[model samples]
Target: MEKYDYEQLVICQDKESGLKAIIAIHDTTLGPALGGTRMWTYASEGAAIEDALRLAKGMTYKNAAAGLNLGGGKTVIIGDPKKDKNEAMFRAFGRYIQGLNGRYITAEDVGTTVEDMDIIHEETNYVAGISPAFGSSGNPSPVTAYGVYKGIKASAKEVFGTDILAGKKVAIQGVGSVAYTLCEYLHDEGAQLIVTDINEEAVQRAVDAFGARAVGLDEIYSVDCDIYAPCALGATLNDQTIPKLNAKIVAGAANNQLELDKHGDLLHQKGILYAPDFVINAGGVINIADELNGYNRERAMKHVDKIYDNLETVFAISKRDNIPTYIAAERMAEERIASLRNSRSTFLQNEHHVISRR
Candidate 1:
């Protein structure tokens, strides 16, 4: 697969800490590449590289759609987060990030935390989402969930002629941190929830807290609901899951929801209104982007609430162009990045050479 098309890819290894990592930068036409560092244990190095490339590209679209003057980059550590994380390892990873200068900035992602970012920050100033005491946003999941909720409402408005989520049935594929917060919002709005997670404890917690009905992991796709929210991982909306979904709308915080580009058109042909994953799940980046200036929870949330309006714009573009929502969102992001690229065609090199053109 021609995954080598990335702008830059760095393979990092630290023998002392037994650390192995990959950082992929997809584009920087808008500005510096910004994304989160994710730690995962993959079956092979190739799998990890593929994931880093895909996620980095997703970040590019996410930043563009969120109207942030940033490009896309991502880091993946080839080890288990629960067992392999330590101060030395992340610090080593940080030194590698520091070597990149400011061309790529990282926060936290799956298997990474704010505390981990703090460790990385000890070695580099090119990190965001450190800690509130460090004048940065701590955790971005709540805002991410908030954006997904707003996107779901936007899709509801397109499908049901109203944005109200009251009495709507939402089948959640995962009840993790972000989805847990999302359940609170949907429950408060009077929406019924059906949750499923590989972690039975997480599913039980959602049932206890939100009165959500727990379902088997395999059954989440076929559940009779108004919306299907895949908050866990990528590629859940694939050939196997799409035909089984009974929901009228698909909106969630998961990145790369579609296994392939063709799956987006499949959803469209099925008459399902889909709120593109990157555009809908951009609240986290929007929140973290605010930390670039200085953390302001109030201002950041106020900006995140704009996801509702952005989804409306995506829907409008989809209707106008007679295309799937995913394609429409990508087109919008590409258009913005293109305009910014032209307006920013000057070379502004820092003395440290932290930001440079390869």
Candidate 2:
């Protein structure tokens, strides 16, 4: 807890339902902690706790960078989403969240689905990403893709002096739901796509739909293109792949794109403009956050579109400080959080003064 400055960690278990979960709350200065519940088959309990804590901290930065009024938290359920899932497990988990009295909110994540979120919603009102029938935002993939698309254009504007993607070759490293939707946006803008994925069917879909050229997973990094989009997994922009990149711009929906902070510095030295992952991929969280205000697609999208301006700010900071974009992104989030903390402290002091006068 001291290492990460975590606020709280709750371990929940229900033997009858075979539910073992860990909820990590990283920060709550802005508001209630909000993040997704990820159900996965972990190697051990320690691994699950670590993952929850790390993800919770990431959500803190992602939410704050996106200008959301929420803090950061994450929940991890240790089990295979394919085989161990039961309504009883999620219901019990939801009860745990309810016991927190709205300190934490959960939505669907990696191994969880909307159906799972719907089940949890039955037990607690502190949930989002439920079915549209529940007056909640359904799927956040498309909105996330839109935000990434906008962020890519912002990165392009910074590096190439133009945001137009027409005729620019972009090597996309994944064709997952979010990346596939992003491809649609890029294709519509007349960008040439080079796509790769471990899933053959997904790659074929992109190739058929967008005329994207399919490449091997290992070959994607070295592909000659104007931009490289690592949409598959985190930490792909490490030493080996960084040396092979031919693109001038690096932008995608993947989290933790850099394996280490030094790699971000390396990119800076190499003159590659990078759009920070959390800021660029905040659309999903931003979408679910709108549920707190009574879900409105129009309003939510307008907020997600601000990702462009957010990246522009990060780039400006990078230029002003002569630092890496990743560092600049964290600086932006930290400044916002610090400003809010200072304002809240003043407000409390004034309130105490007024009471003392009374």
Query: Who wins the lDDT comparison?
Result: 2
Candidate lDDT values, in order: 0.91, 0.95
**Distance (Å) between predicted and true CA of 52, model 1?**
0.7
Compute the lDDT of residue 18 as modeled in candidate 2: 100
lDDT, candidate 2, at 55 = 88
Runs in model 1 deviating more than 4 A are: 1-5, 345-358
lDDT of each residue in 35-138, candidate 1, tens digit only: 99999999999999989999999999999999888999999999999998889999999999999989999999999999999999999999998888888878
Query: In candidate 2, what are the lDDT values of residues 116-137, reduced to their tens digit?
Result: 9999999999999999999999
lDDT of 2 at 100: 98
Which 10-residue window of candidate 1 scores lowest in summed lDDT?
346-355
TM-scores, all candidates, are 0.94, 0.97
